[model samples]
Target: MRNVVIGFLGTQLDMGKRRRWRPTVDLCRTEGFPVDRLELIHDHKFNRLAHSVKRDIEEASPETEVLLHRMDMDDPWDLEEVYTKLFDFASDYGFDEDRERYHIHLTTGTHVGQICWFLLSESRHIPAALIQTGPPRGGDDVGTFDLIDLDLSRYDALQQRFDQQTREYGDLLKGGIKTRNVAYNRLIDRIEQVAGLSDAPILLQGESGTGKSELAQRIYELKLQRRRVKGRLVHVNCATLRGGTANATLFGQRRSFTGQAGTERAGLLREADGGVLFLDEIDALGLEEQALLLHAIEAGQYYPLGSDAEVTSRFQVIAGASGDLSAMVSEGVFRIDLLTRLNLWTFHLPALRDRPEDFEVNLRHELAQAEKTLGIRVGFNSDASEAWLRFASAPGTLWPGNFRDFSGAILRLCTLAPRGRITRAQVVDEIATLERRWRAADTDQNSQLVAKYVNGPVDPFDIPQLANVLHTCQTSATISEAGRRLFAVSREDRKSRNDADRLRKYLAKFDLSWAELNDG
Candidate 1:
């Protein structure tokens, strides 16, 4: 079967000064070309311009079937969104490798589009070899092309070096955080690779106090160490930038405005001209600001509030948001284009509650941080330390604000500690205070039900099992349902699947019956 070819039409397809035999026609009409069908992806915005080129191809290449697809992209230069749309289209197209071989025409589309196609092909997402068209060396059609595969497997030496560098980057990210969780370590490893190479905008999504700012700072520090950035890191909290001041603070204004200042004030974008710019709480920023930010991020160009001249700021933006951006996009609040740019390299930092394994390691690090920052040594008394660790990591102990709360806990204890030593009294008070706060905030029926049914002073060692039981009970409609949910994964191993009986026995330890617990 003749190889099926897929390509996106760029503006140059018809707008170029060069005469007949445009790249699309040449790719199809070239002598001995093996195109069974040519799939052309075009944006509706350029419908009129694309129509002429589509007609020209049909008239010139009668042998190949030309199929046109209408794909829309808000910005041609925003490859992040462009790739996502194209990848989705390709995925849904569902190529049948058994029936026909495929080839991707790489000469068409924007430079951004071409790069995205190359990346998709490399990852096997496109499932095709590359077909690159160009002007002949001597006197041939410009669209006469050559087929090639990246064949990265052949470069053993380069691959080895890359693997080694990746390991080193991973080590650097974990140097100070002291994280022990395997999944978190892998996440940091991927982050290190992206941080070192791509200058594309990075979005760090998570809860309010889930270390997004700290990670961004570390990324900046890593970039600085590698000589990737020359200037200092500029951080802006979107929550702090409000109303009329938001635009002026981010984009800057000329010194000669109605409320003219003595000297010209550079905006945050300009301040981070050659380094990293981190925007925290990006969900709080205005929609207008997000639109301007899209231009700045995509093209590195933005006009100041009071200036007619456009300014350029080349900086890597690391944005942090606590909630879902897609929901904001649907709500018509956050610009989808801005979110698209930032979504290129998104890394969601798991909240402390999610990664319980890292709690002990992070807790120790927090205390160490207190010691280092305050120039004071504070050690936990044996009983006090045990009690605090047990309560902190146990199930139903909701750490509402994550590490931020944990940090405050350390500070409060450190401040109240007598003679630089934490005692039992302080630990109990801290636990009681935190529990009260979570109880007041947590209105979830499952949460309230768990607290009501579960035994007091949740043991840290039994946290996992207790949590599982509580969750099972909360979700199960009947005692049998809860037992089935718990045993579904392990039923094969158990000789007797006494789901309801098992659930009843377990609830007995908490001084409660299934009928009694179910009512709560």
Candidate 2:
């Protein structure tokens, strides 16, 4: 394979002192690593120097071919301009990997140029290994040269730095909480990669309060930190956009349409130009809005309400959905095209009940947040801490509202704690309040289920017990499992171990049968 060396013509280094040889000329005369062709990149101002270097290279190694490529740069230190120019040059260059091996010389350019070269090579924009040249250490004028392959996995230190960076990105998304849930951590890792690497529309699917909005904001912030975005993050809850005004609110409306003397409004889409648009509860968007959004996302152009001129807003979308958008599309309530675009990078955040392992970590985080907000450092007593953990980590505990419910509980505990100390009494009280709130939210749905079985209106006192029993029955695989769970404390005392029969007897009170319930 022919060896092709591409580098910037070092104006000062190539024009060396009286005794020293030019680095480029010396590189051509390298002992074993022979350069078949040297592609020297320089500006118009250094044309004479480039020619002189080429002449010296030809004299040093008569077999090597020297090609001068002119790349004009107002400032070689401007990373963006230098990178773009170099990228264009590399793109235009005819590269044949089968016949020619490429090497990017890093010793010639400015530090900024060197960085751009490294980025381009590492990203495989230029299919080449980096060749760095240094001054001669001994009597050999060719100097010492090192070949650095762009494959990062070959270097343990570089790989470790990348791994650390990935972890930091995950941590940022997690609000600095060191979550121990294996599945959640893996999900965060994938999200971190997608957030940094791609601008494709991201669909965050999870139950309400599962940190979808928070994760979207964090993704925007991460992109901003990486300089991937310039404009601010525009957050809009699609659920809030309703009625005829939804169209005007999202895509903007002219003052003439409003029939008022006010400035034209640039809607959420335009507001998010050059940045990110976080549409929380995106499934709530009407069909018309969804179609318009799809067009904007795909074409980067959309017409505002009552406007003929199409406005362009090239923004990345991080959509949040609590409900199943695919199911909605099946039902003809959602646009399949929009869902298809958004589904390219979908991440489902697990519910709090599903990730019990992260309870303690999130608990501590919420406590710290509560302390900061309340301006008081509250500490839980040993017994209180144990009680809190036990209740939160219980098998039957259901966190329907996920982190929001958990955070609210912690805030309440901190708020109600006496003298900045939460004792067992406070823990017990908070647990009761949480259980009551959760049960109250389920009462209406559970009551309807109970009403279907019973002949008459159920007593308010028996409703909670019946609701719990019905829920257990619906969720359990078999009658025995439900019975074992429901009568767990009392079953040990009973000599007869017919749990199914016991469950049947209990259900018989409301004229409900196991087979009938399961069949229904």
Candidate 3:
């Protein structure tokens, strides 16, 4: 097997044969174990030193290809930066594990560099065995080396933990197996591992209908299975938390004192004590409430509306936001520090439109669910199944609603199928029905948008005409300006050029004046 070595060039790597031997030179010269390649990474500051080491290795073993790469990092002591650069370099380069067996040389460079190499090897980013070199044992110029293959399975505790967590995730999958999406399943696996390992706050970000709420519930269920949590999974929609009532609802209401609102019962935080708390649309939380929530997360203590004694709830907060909290933070709508606390583990659920490949699988899963819920087993004939697949999996079909749309399609199919088996005709009718429904909804939405300009109701049938007229008027600053715009195009062809009067006549057609639309 061809052995490839990856490591950072140390300050002592090129030390001549005074008291010790060089790792690169010795590894290449080791008897009966020829290294096919030595990939040395170093900063630009070590350009001359790197060149000298490369020459020494070449001289020691002309067969070994000593490929030197210049890595960009400001500090060798910065573990994050060093690890990131090395990981990126390994990813960008052709480090194909199928082509060669690799070894990570951890003996050279700073201690931070060695640790980064170890982590990269552990994570399989380097896809190599970690090799640590020691001083020559026989007092010769060569050194002794230890090669460690970082296979977690070999470690009983870690392997068992991984297996147990994976099994728990598989259990969670049972509750929402509406699709066989590989990417999504892999995401679930990662989430399962994170959920098992940490109860730290998790942030779920995705568009609407991406199943964030369901996933959060499943995570809670898995935790329950593992006995990680001891209380109920308390969920609260932050969108509903508005005004003074929002604070009382979240933190707890104070008992009534004349002319004051009293919250005698426990709030969401208290309800979720020692359990999982899911906050949906977390961005909707007001600034003051956000501060209190932040304090709760940090200190696990908060005062109720009317009480001075700080009530406590050791709740594991999983906040969900439909949009980017960072953007909101930039706009001063969200607290940066609070976001930073929740940002530790953020998972983005992708929209359904991007995963069309899983449509058929999801279609079947949804049907299975319908079978249980509707109390009737439904089967799709060959032709109907094929037809549905064509429309559902087609690139042009935008499933803007994601999984929710998929479920809705199944609902429509199940509701319409009079017989147990679905036929091609039914599929055609349903597709047509959905198309018309979506188009009408789109048109209605457009009409409603146009309606925002009018102070009073306009004829719904005339929305298209009114929209066209309003769009044209917006092209110019005033009625006269708009009139000139229209006349500019047609004045040459018209017998009489009365621009403003013509504009006035058009406005009269819509029962609207220029001032009405442009009142800023």
TM-score: which candidate is best?
A: 2
- TM-score (all chains, Cα) for each model: 0.55, 0.70, 0.57
Off by more than 4 A, model 1: 1-168, 440-520
Which is the winner by lDDT between candidate 2 and candidate 3? Answer: 2
Q: Look at candidate 2 and tell me the lDDT of residue 69.
A: 92
- State the lDDT of candidate 3 residue by residue for 302-390, as single tens digits: 98887778998998878899988987786688999999999899998888877776777778788998888889979899999999989
User: What local distance difference test score does each model get?
Assistant: 0.81, 0.89, 0.82
Task: Estimate the TM-score for candidate 2.
Answer: 0.70
* Candidate 3 accuracy as lDDT: 0.82
Q: What TM-score does prediction 3 earn? A: 0.57
The true-versus-predicted C-alpha distance at residue 159 of model 1, in Å, is 11
Q: After superposition, how far is residue 505 of candidate 1 from its true place, in Å?
A: 39
lDDT agreement of model 2 with the native? 0.89
